[model samples]
Target chain A: MSLSLENVSAGYAGRPVLSGLDLAEVPSGSIVALVGANGAGKSTLLRGIAGLGEAKGRIVLDGQDISELPPEMLVGRIGYLPQALPQGSSLIAYEAVMSAVRAARPDSPRAGGAAAIEQVFDTLGLRDLAMRRLRELSGGQRQMVGLAQVLVRKPRLLLLDEPTSALDLRWQLTVLETVRRMADAEGAICVIAIHDINLALRFCDRLVVLGGGGVLSSGPPATALDADVLRRAYGIEARVEACSRGFAIVLADHALSLDHHSP
Target chain B: MTRHLTALQERSASLADLYGGFIRNRLIAIGLLAVGLACSLVLDVATGPSGLPVADILTGLLDRDALPRGQAVILWNIRLPYAVMAVLVGAALGLAGAEMQTVLNNPLASPFTLGVSAAATLGAALAMALEPDVPGLDETWLIPLSAFACAMAATLLIQTLAGRFGAGTDTVVLFGIAMLFAMNALLWLVQYVASTDALQQMVFWTMGSLARATWEKVAVVALVLAACVPLSMRSVWAMTALRGGDDHARSFGIPVERLRLRVLLRVSLLSAAAVAFVGTIGFIGLVGPHIARLTLGEDHRFYLPGSALAGALLLSLASIASKNLVPGLILPVGIVTSLVGIPLFMALILTQGRRP
Candidate 1:
């Protein structure tokens, strides 16, 4: 079960956001990191894959064309954790997760559904606050609740947009680790758009660096974090060094003046 | 480790426990409605221009032949229809109010807030002012038919105007208010042109009375509510998703605009039917749903039916209270509802404000 994007072009209205973007097949059961600057079309690429945007060209899921499928139908096969978590009024934590489970399977038996959703809550360590209302939860706790809904169905393809952007340091590591475990254990293909290079290097198996609405480099962390690629994509001079666990790209200075002098 | 496992078990059970919780809440609400309805029936029979004892009222209801002709006329012709009309109209308003609030995604949204009742009133006024002088035209059917038409028109107009301004709550409320003013002005025009007797009739209509609730009128209102309530319930999942927000609902396969339009139409029909027969009964739509939510929480499946039942009970109780206010001098049913509903709603708002 792999997802392939072939010559995919998409945009809002008539203005192009991602143009002629080509990528090799994304293998299942791997944590693939999509790293790009703001407005580099990282989010748009994810949205296009999730069938939440208009795009030209084929998005084949498990070798099946799914470009024309509506979001609801595609939702059953793909789970998307949107940038903003939904705020339900007066809904307790347990009720909120159960509602999402019901949405995915409205006719499932009560006991079975309860057990399945409970597995997610237990995994996320959200059981302690299950009876509390959403408004009562802290920001990190709320994000966990949001994550529980996405994982409840154990979807094949998971699309997460900046899942750690709103979290504290503790929650950020917790969520990234959870995503990695989910991909490994459930054989789910995970694509996360992340800003923290260190976090991605630690968790992601492969990194696809996007710039100017296209893939600039795609390989292991060491090759993807080369000085030239980092300088070209983010306009930063970076020293790529090896670590015991993985490679790290350390930002030295702005690479803008280097471009001017070289030309 | 054992304590942590136990805690996890408790938390897991909590989410699954809502089904039982929702059922228990609904049962309590239904029980309260039953008690209120019984009290209404007893009060309706006991108090009138001619007062009777509780025993006599029960005897009359159980064995109609035992009652005297005039008492029979009052019981069967006037009181019965009045009580039935109150229940039906209250149920309609309550259901419509709940539906509107869910669809509009605003706690303040109601049929009256959207100027539905005012539009119905304008239609009733037009019917009175333009009474056909033809020999066979009946005045009784004129108000209801015209009111239904006008209400539907108002619903379509509001949708179109709201669409133009973007379908946000603020824009919808503003458009509704503007329509209310425009309709009220039209109503005043009708009053100005009407004869003295006709003008008095119009004023009485505006005050909202169950005095005119005949068997035929009760049947119409009941039929409308019966159709509207079931239809509205079909959107329970969509409405529940809607509570999450528009984007959430859309992601769940609900076509938000189409669902909104369907709910708006049903609410408009319900409101128009209630107002056409009973005049502009206000606070039942506003207060009844709020009471239901206080008891049933915000889940629409429970909230919608709970609101309908509570509305019926509240309206019937109000009608009974108005009848008993002055034994020989009957106040309009609307007065009793407002007198009871306003303070109750204010208290709810105040209490909710104090909470997180």
Candidate 2:
């Protein structure tokens, strides 16, 4: 499936944060990273696409304009994980994921539920926490469970906002790696609003740099990320240099004056 | 690749086993609570002013001919209705409290938080103070009917206000609290200007006794509770998802706004019916859900019924204590409920290794 955005504008309380923005087709089986400085509408863009907040634009999925589709219509087709992880639930991780599955797919037969939930638990390595209460789990652990709740549904489109903000380095790579494998295996389109540029380059097929209330650049990471885009979007003097293994790495030199290039 | 597949299957099976065990434990707790409720019902029926043996109550339940006329009159006419009313009202309040807490996202929220009880009290006070004279309605039915009407009026007011603005949690809770204070002030106003006899009756009504219970009142509350349980069960998964947060539930395509409004409506019906029939039994609605959460976790499949059963059990035991505690004179069941509920609630809180 291909997803595209046309003249998408989104914000809260009648204040437009990202407006008149357009994005090219993001094909199925591709992972695209949304990278920008703070307050650059990375979350607004994702929330707009997810239909969580107020937005005025067309979000087309597979050539069908789904922007006007009610949230119930988008249940099984789209999954969005918010930046804030869930807290204060006494439900265990397994039950929480099961609740997501049951709530999203209310009419589905219950026979396949056990297998689907178990597979997600295995994929996310949350078997040990299946019986542990969410309130007892640490923040990073709860973040993993939150992702598990989303992943268990196997939505055609996955939108993750800051999925790795609470994780350690090991878990950070593990989560990204899992998302990458799932996207390819299931032919799902994954759009992650993330802040870590290098990690985005490492796992994502393309980068969409958002700034100035619109897209600054959009292409393969090797083409879209560079010194100029970084300086313009983030107001940081940075270098996009090739490492010994020929992978792109960003090295920051200094912060430029924010008065000129602030989004 | 085959070995990897086998290992994955094993891991999945083990995880399923663990989940099954957890579910089994919750089911067992539910079963135990049901059994306890049944035992408490029997105990409540037997412990009264005139000592009726448990053996006689059980035998008389199946074979009415077994007991003498006087004993049978006591069992069928007075004790049985009172005990059954206690269970049904407790269950209604318990279920209402569970939904109230879930929708409001507050552990401290109960049916009383919405001002239904206070409204009912005000209605009762007004009835006592004014002594309204209607041709068909009996004096016996006036207080409860008036109380039920006022409680439902309060609910409708909240519903309209929420629909006008938004049924967001903070807004709904704030409105409920505001209604509570307003109703209390109006009730005090009614009580202040009443005669000595009317004032005493108002005080007695607010204390909430099951002494006036009849089989008809018991049946009405039962019907309301029956209708509500299925609706609550239908939203079980969505309610469970909501415990994560509102945004989380909305992510699952569970319309959080509509769900909250619907639950509040159900809570209002249950609370109004309960507090209408049995004065203002406050403790069960608040503590029933807490007991369920502590023992059975937050899976609404178990937790909802668990709350109901817990409420019934707590109220039944309180009924027995009220009858037997001060021999020859039964304290108000509401007074006994607090006396019984607080100690058990504190015990559960202390014994549980963790609090969520």
Best by lDDT: 2
The ten-residue window of minimal lDDT in model 1 chain A covers A254-263
**Could you give candidate 1's per-residue lDDT for residues B1-356 as a string of tens digits?**
99999777665565557446756766877787778777876777566777677776678888988888788777888878888888889899999898888777677777798788888888887877777664565778787778877977998998887667666656767888898998888888888989887787778888889888999899989888878877877667567656666655544445677777778778888998899888989888888888887777666767888888888888888887897778677899888888888888899999877866
RMSD of each: 4.3, 3.3
**lDDT by candidate, in order shown:** 0.77, 0.88
Task: Please give fnat for model 1.
Answer: 0.19
Task: Give the poorly placed runs of model 1, Cα more than 4 Å off.
Answer: A12-16, A37-45, A68-72, A85-88, A104-112, A195-197, A208-220, A226-244, A247-263, B1-26, B133-137, B158-200, B324-328
Query: Which lDDT value does model 2 have at B211?
Result: 92
True contacts kept of 2: 0.74
lDDT of model 1, residue B222 = 85
Top-DockQ structure, candidate number: 2
Per residue, candidate 1 scores C-alpha lDDT tens digits across A1-263 of 78887899977656788888776788888888999777777777887776666688888888877856655567677877767654536566666666665654555546237778777878887777776667667666777877787788678888888888878888798888888888888788999998888788778888988886688888777677788887777877777776766557555565576553231
Off by over 4 Å in 2: A68-71, A256-263, B1-13, B350-356
